[model samples]
Target: MTPKQIERIQNKIKKIKRALAADKKHWGGYYHDGQGLRYLPPQFYLEINDYSGAMRYFNWFNKNFEEDSGYPIFLFEWTITLFKKKKVKEAEKKALETFCSNTYLIDVFLGKDMLEFNKNESSNWEYSSLIEHLIYSKDQEELSDFYIWLENFTTSQTFYDFANKFIEIEKAINDEPMGKKRSQLFDEKLKLLESIK
Candidate 1:
């Protein structure tokens, strides 16, 4: 596009940021009470190649809503932003979080057959599921390097080990009775996630 067109898009993004900020202030909640609006600024900033701006909004959203679940696409973009900033470990952690959020995403990206998995069990259609990944999947040509890195990382033996352990833990969690043993399994799961290298 022409410079004028780019400028117009930038101005529109600025307006959107202002409007979202105003709405959040008026509503008096954490990003409109956990609505998807929180992803807008970062998404827009990334589109405009404003990495710092995108990172700032991503940091704010994560800091304020650490306990809340993140959208798969949001986490994926955040991983890209972090990787661009040379934050490799943080990017890997976010990638793992994204994978855990939707196990089918990497498989889909890699063109692996997913027919063996029970689609009904993973069809949330909103968060952390194959349907959500399909809904959010878009061509990100500018992020090719990030995709390459992700492909390599996800295919690594280390990742496979972690993934297998995570699945085992999930199975144990589901099978164990609702008691201290189950709680310990949950703790083990959390530790395993945090232990991602």
Candidate 2:
């Protein structure tokens, strides 16, 4: 929260935003073919209790990228920001928008239904925020609906294609630590897949 910390975080955010701008095609989805933009920089802001900084990242991103292609997780953060600011109606709207965007992939990844399948290569902010919502939700219907979609999608060929690529990529890695992590992740994904019902 010091001036130095703020500057460091701002610099990191600028660097990430520039990188993501250059690689616009790889934005969105559960996987990335390159280093991929992560929710980490913005997440770091949140960790430091810099809610305004986090909102700035989300707002800037939304302005620069298409809603569907921009990181869907940003909406979750936006929703959190809105809620914290006591803009309940706007927060609810953003929350619904977040849930509806990239339905299959986001739900599966954020719900942690097949988290290891993502190789921990992505952000968990969306999951964390959604869990927070679920913890206080007056209605459980949305949660059930989300799992229903996840269960169905996991059974589809689209999900298999995504998983297969992840498997293939991890299998080719020569790094021992990464390989071990991949193996553990693969196992965890399998268990999650089996237990999703």
Candidate 3:
């Protein structure tokens, strides 16, 4: 990619990150991706402990779809797992159809297939690296936004106190075997509710 292309993709990433921050309150679930299924976001597939964080991902997804990069479908375990097996089966079918689509992303580096990392593999933290890479090379506004959110959101002593539980919850979800992704999401929602209460 040329300097201009790099800059454009970088800028799109920023918009996505910002949008993700904006809607971090939504629980995970199966969402639409305008055209059949080729353009789907990662939220449609992963289980999330934090509703707000998942919402943020969705928010970014909507923004990205609008940007014509591609639409993202979420596999929000917390929200979608509640459906009956029949429903899940149907949704999964549609999701797979979208997943198999050819309208891949044209971003800075990896396209929409960034979610290809194996969740069960021991070294599958590669997707997180994408986040790190984008954030690591972020320009002024993104860095500032991240700092503000991190400092302002996580600096509370109460939040720090709950960090261990959060970590545990996250680990449980990330370490799950197939068909059990939503197991830890409830614990997280309960924790968030407790915090709010």
Q: 46 in model 1: Cα distance from truth in Å?
A: 3.3
| Each model's lDDT | 0.69, 0.51, 0.36
Q: What TM-score would every model get versus the actual structure? A: 0.76, 0.39, 0.28
- For candidate 2, report its TM-score: 0.39
Best by TM-score: 1
- Tens-place lDDT digits, model 1, residues 1-197: 57786687678777776776787788785356444566656566666677787788787776777776676767777887898888988888888877766666766665565423222232252233444434223246766677788878888887788777877777777678789998998899888877753
Tell me the tens digit of each residue's lDDT in model 2 across 10-121. Answer: 7887788667665665555323426546555655565455777777676665665432333555555566566655565666556445543333334444454533332233
- Model 2, stretches more than 4 Å misplaced? 1-8, 21-35, 67-72, 101-197
Cα lDDT for residue 29, model 1?
57
Lowest lDDT sum, 10 consecutive residues, model 2, at 133-142
